[model samples]
Target: MSTASAHAPAASVAPPPPGPRTEPLLGNMRALRRAPLDYFLAQVREHGDVVRFWLGPKPVTLVAHPDGVRHVLQDNVRNYNKQTRGFAVVRELLGQGLLTSEGDFWLRQRRLAQPAFHRQRLASFASTMVEAAEELATRLDARCAPGAAFDVAEEFNHLTLSVTSRTLFGSDIGASVSRDIGEALARVQAFANARLTQLLPLPRALPLPSHLRMRRDLDMLDRVVRELIERRRADTGTHHDLLAMLMEARDEDTQERMSDTQLRDEVMTLMVAGHETTASALSWTMVLLSRHPDVRRRLETELAQVLQGRSPTVEDLPKLALTRRIIDESMRLFPPAWISSRAALQDDVIGGYHIPAGSFVLVSPWVTHRHPRLWENPEGFDPDRFLPELERERSRFTYFPFGGGPRQCIGNQFSLMEMVLVLATLVSRLRLDLAPGHPFVPAPAITLRPRPGVWMTASRPRAATPASGTGQ
Candidate 1:
């Protein structure tokens, strides 16, 4: 047996991952644009975990298995870079911030931003999240009649925008400011998505309508960010907000600080990343909770027992296991950062398939989270799957809502803490039910947003006491 194994023929080279026929030059671009989420889901389901496709002349590989995802995101992360078309579009808005930067520069920025998101620092921001949720509850109470429908998506967007603004910049972003930023981000995201999907996008310098508008929106974002930075600089007292921390941070090796341009990029990155994604997650959670009454009941019970009608603090987080699980499951189902792409910096093998250099590697949480082999009842909504024991049995890459490895989201802890506090505060006080006849559709853009926005009816919780006041 040993002699036979030693002389065994070499393993056969596996053929490339299967894919559907593509038009010569168009190359599946139409299918991608028609329904990106559905298209990707079908690719993985029909073609197995590692599927290959083309975008015109460019090669795109969809990695749907956890092991393969680990290979790209963690094990050989250096061989993959964020120089993909998707990130290029993001950079048009974010500049050379941590989200878009690569190499040694990204390392320096990550280190500088790391301390501000330390557990201790995030603990202090709980009050801000609770306060924002309380204000939202009060506003919803006044605007939404009992059993009458309103846009929960809009409300969550406003609430999270408020929370992120106060926590990151130490200033209240009022309705007007939030509206300005929101509109600008929407425009930028739309343009970016168009550019990402287009086989050959128009040049930005062409003065085309979309390009012109994107530039204008980008300028608006810059103005707001610079204004915030200027305001922080003019203030006399030291603040503990993220902006202050970033401003004071210095490279231990070089003793250099981030310039104003760098500051603007980082601040804008925080605002966009911190606000929009959390709001999308919360909105989806609310929708899921309303649809799954049993889960919602359990969540309400957990909130009541842990919060006791008081605001949730950072200390209360671990105890609110169900709340965290609900958020996790919601993100699993409808992750805001649903799909992320990386460009291969060098040729490598992932899951036994050859990946050529400069190829686009797609790691979609949307597809992997529902992979049949990894998840029992893959389409079902069950938060208990995230119970510690069960979660420990799963692969780390199976449920990466905040992504995995070093390039993972920087403010993940901050987002989770904020969601927990805000969800606890609001759910304890109000019962949100999806409005009758309102369709639930996921809009896959740069971030996942509800297409027409989630419409819901807000009412006082049946078991809760009358509100004496809002927030702690």
Candidate 2:
């Protein structure tokens, strides 16, 4: 499964028959630019689950079938490497953190980080989630101001950012810093995907405008992370935070704790992935709720009936089944991690299509989750689609917001708890309704964000009863 074997010069790693080609060098770039998702979907319609094309000059393969996705993510994982488009920028900001590092380095980092997210341990973080949600509720309650409208997306982004900052570094990300980081992150992601440099292959040190801005953004984040690390190092008292747990973690084999640089990378990795994606998910949830009144009302009714009137805890999650269903549906419509890309290390056949070594393979949750053949009313938002009874009849890859297999988001459980608690707490207290005729379009960035922001109105629920809300 080694890359050497996959790309062995002596071996014929290319598919038995390579994918069809278009006119000379134009490739499939123009078609993709016109309508990327539809273009890929059309390929699946014509050529079946596996389709190969060029993104400008680079060769890429798109897989749509469940087995095809599983083969790339699990069985033949070692025959693939992270693709350049996404990882290159991620590596620039995070360095050798779990997301970008490969081989033993990533393995060691994952081992050290996994304990903090263990089932028993994550229970302690529920209170933290509730506390963050309470603050969010308080902010929104104060903002209601009798018939005033607010950007639900912005509000949720702030809420998730608060949770992420407090949970990861035990810091309150102020408005200015949050706005700065958010804007910078957006710019960096946009610039990376623009493929401006694919035509030039500029070095990291190049002094281009985009590069300079990205560097400045990285410097700002680095400064903040280093300061957090220094403060944590200075504290001698025992703290039950992720940072403390990471600091205490040791490699079983090497018995070496993480160094400051390693700590910085890990912290930044969590901050970036933790906040941005969660925020987008929450935002989209609100948008979906606005669009689907019945679902939102049922969610509120469940919160009222189940909790009476209290924040959720770990034990309460199973009972909050409907709320979880709403969140799941939102994710299916707009998964935070929209697309995952990897380069084939060895030529492999997926869905009867031959993929050559070094070719980039894209398994997009956005594309597959909404595939016409795989989903009923694929473009519609419906929570019942995730009901265990119904899901049992569907293909595994038909719904993978957090992905599947080992490479799935390690923070999946934690994130789910966070989202459920936040939603339950907020919806139990406030009624969110979408602005009439407001256009809510999907903007597929690092996460699927609402293009115009989720605009909605918030009103308090008319009830006063003692109810405990816990994470199940």
Best by lDDT: 1
What number of clashing residue pairs does each candidate have, in the order they appear? 0, 11
TM-score of each prediction: 0.94, 0.90
Candidate 2 per-residue lDDT, tens place, 347-435, comes to 77775556777878988888888788888898898888888889899767777888776677888888899999998999888877777
In terms of lDDT, the poorest run of 10 residues in model 2 is 1-10
Off by over 4 Å in 1: 1-14, 144-147, 464-472
Writing each residue's lDDT as its tens digit, candidate 1 over 1-472 gives 0101224332244345578789989998899888989899888878788889889988899998888888889878888999988898889888889889999999999998888888898898888888889998897777557667899898887888888788888878777988898888877877887788788888899988878888888888888889888888889997988889999999999999888999998888888888899999999999888889887777777776767768888789878888888889999999999999999887666666667778999999999998888999988999889888898999789889888999999889999988888888888888888988888789888899998899999887778332322111
Candidate 1 Cα lDDT to native: 0.84
Native-structure RMSD, model 2? 4.2
lDDT of each: 0.84, 0.77
TM-score (C-alpha, index-matched) for candidate 2: 0.90
In model 2, the Cα lDDT at residue 19 comes to 50
Task: Show the colliding residue pairs in model 1.
Answer: none
